[model samples]
Target: MPRPEDSVWAVSVAQVASRPGQSKPIDTVFPAPAGIGDSVVGVREGADIRVVGSFDSIVDGLVFTGRFEAPVTAECTRCLKPIDPDWTVPVTAFFPYDSGACRDDRRTGHGKDDVEIVAGEDESEDVYPLSPDGAFADMESLLRDTLVEALPLQPLCREDCLGLCPQCGADLNEDPDHHHDVTDIRFAALEQLKAQLEAEQTGR
Candidate 1:
């Protein structure tokens, strides 16, 4: 059986978990978990992810408040240019001391229903489970969830990208004057009829 502490994402919090009002600071790097996003816009798996934050102990759980920084790779939505940038996201999550008790309470309808309802109403913070012995808090799921939610759906290299020309697929940013002289469709039939009359007069 693998130990919880053996995991790379696990952080030992036994010192702070012993009592309320204690705090533990964390400043370290962990590998990015898989499935943060897709090829279009995402952080690569195994990329370095920096976490800077602290865990504060409360009566029921530990509250982690910090920032996550990772390398994000994406393409510009308008121009289709490749872009790689560092993305920073603020995160706050709860590592409950007794997750099983909370689950049992919900199942049996026997404890703290009002408290649970009030907690559920505030969707800003996320909740995760600590190790069975409450000695370690694994952050794999939290990191994945945070980064995934923070990914931009429509990423851009620049705000005012001109994109590609519709007629010839030319880069509008590179060639601002590039264009085609297109005759109006409404005048096409009349132009053809006038040409035919001229041709017939010449033949006659």
Candidate 2:
């Protein structure tokens, strides 16, 4: 296949057709998203991706896959700052079923669950791209999406996350010594009633 001018960038294949286990190829690193919040940009490294085959039949499907230890530079959960977070996903996926057979298979997580894989389509792209002409998807988009989907509805820098305090909008984790108390709206009425009762008793 055609490659870029950089010799450092190359695609390699393993002995897979012979063993019917995995077909090897060079991996690529995609770009990350802009701004804060959870992002999926793995450290760039030259690794191999293999396409595994199913034993039952030779259906037009994506082959064997694997996951690598992906190192993500993210912010610390506590400080709202960047931190190197190690994240991983099943990098290898199969467009196993052709046009008809490719059903939404969420339980297994190998095939399309909500997204649709076109039939009679070229599987040449990356696994995560809208187009996978190279059998490699854009890791940034795919992994980023996974990271966002997996993140808590409410994110924290850390478990003991010092969230923004309501009163002063300060990080509780940063300055634990600071304290504040809220006024009691409901109890204010009760206090007034108590004063009236005290006056009635004193008067009687």
Candidate 3:
């Protein structure tokens, strides 16, 4: 069977221009693309990113909101053991297309001399961007960023991970009592002197 993430989900703005206030179902799989790195925000590569949502044409732009889920495979932060877990989260984003007329309509009430400005930071930061020429609204960048952002910074296999032994590099979960004979750095010179004396006495 074809994995859900193997296909790209792109919608042309032209297709939805005629319809307003209508919701279109968006369900597809986002395959791991090349050069996107194996570990996105937190999701591992090759895992399928399932996107299920709808697209609607609002006044100024299009809005996409849906639930996204994927299986995650990564090494445990503490023990370095393989960890496979399911990652799921809800995603909501807006994509603004060439809507200069829409903005003008929204600003109609304001005085002619009054200029409209973006409420805060660059408007693009909050909403995804569609093609300037009103061609297609690409979902690749949004999916990559949303999935990555949903991943935990440090994923653990279990709550109480025993981790690994600092001395012998052994898994503490398996060998909790594993240890090694450690020499104190402060006594290094004395131990070297004692070894030299013992060698001289044996030679004599």
Candidate 4:
């Protein structure tokens, strides 16, 4: 069987988990986990992801407050230009000591009713499980969740992108004054009739 600490995302927290109020600083780079986002806007798998923060042990769990820096690839929603930017996301997640307690609480119907009653009033923090021995905290799911949620719904190359021309498909940012002389549809019949009469007169 594979050991929990063997995982790439696992961080050794045995010392901190020994007592409450303990602190452990985490500053390292891990490979970006899969499923962060779609191809249109996402961090590519195996990309470098830097995490800088600390884990503070509470009475029953460890709270991780950190910032994630990742390289995100996307296309501008309006201009359709390729954009690659370094995205930074702030994250706070809980790694409970007794991981099975939450499941047991729900199974026994103890906390389920209370949760449903005050679901609107409560804002639940992201919760992850520590290793069975409580020695390691795997960060794969946390990293994936944070990055996915922070991805921009509509990415833009720039704030003032002019986008493409609707009629000619020309890049408006390159030629701001580009346009077509469009005759109004309301006066189309009159203009065509006038042109036909002028042609007949010229022919006569």
Candidate 1: tens digits of C-alpha lDDT, residues 1-204: 999999999999999994889999999999999999999999999999999999998766788999999999999887788999998999988887886665566667665743364266234558888899999999999999999999999999988988888888888888888899999999999999999999999999
Locate the minimum summed-lDDT window of 10 residues in model 1.
113-122
lDDT of 4 by residue, 1-204 (tens): 989999999999999995878999999999999998998999999999999999998756688989999999999988888999998899888887774654565457666643342232224648788899999999999999999988999999999999999997899999999999998999999999999999999999
Rank by lDDT (best first): 1, 4, 3, 2
TM-score of 3: 0.67
Total clashing pairs for each candidate: 0, 30, 5, 0
Model 3, 1-204: lDDT tens digits are 643233365665566743657677877787654333344224655558788888877645667778887776677778888876777789777765545554664457442221222222135454677766555667777777766666676778898998988877898888777888999999999999999999999999
Q: Name model 2 segments beyond 4 Å from true.
A: 1-19, 25-28, 32-62, 68-84, 96-152, 187-204
On TM-score, who's better, 2 or 4? Answer: 4
Top model number, TM-score: 1
**Which of candidates 2 and 3 reaches a greater lDDT?**
3
lDDT score, candidate 4, position 200: 100
After superposing candidate 4 on the true structure, give the runs of residues whose Cα lies further than 4 Å from its correct spot: 100-125, 199-204
lDDT of 4: 0.86
**Predicted structure 3: lDDT:** 0.66
Error of 2 at 23 (Å): 3.6
Off by over 4 Å in 3: 1-7, 12-18, 35-47, 99-124, 131-135, 181-183, 187-204
Off by over 4 Å in 1: 102-125, 185-187
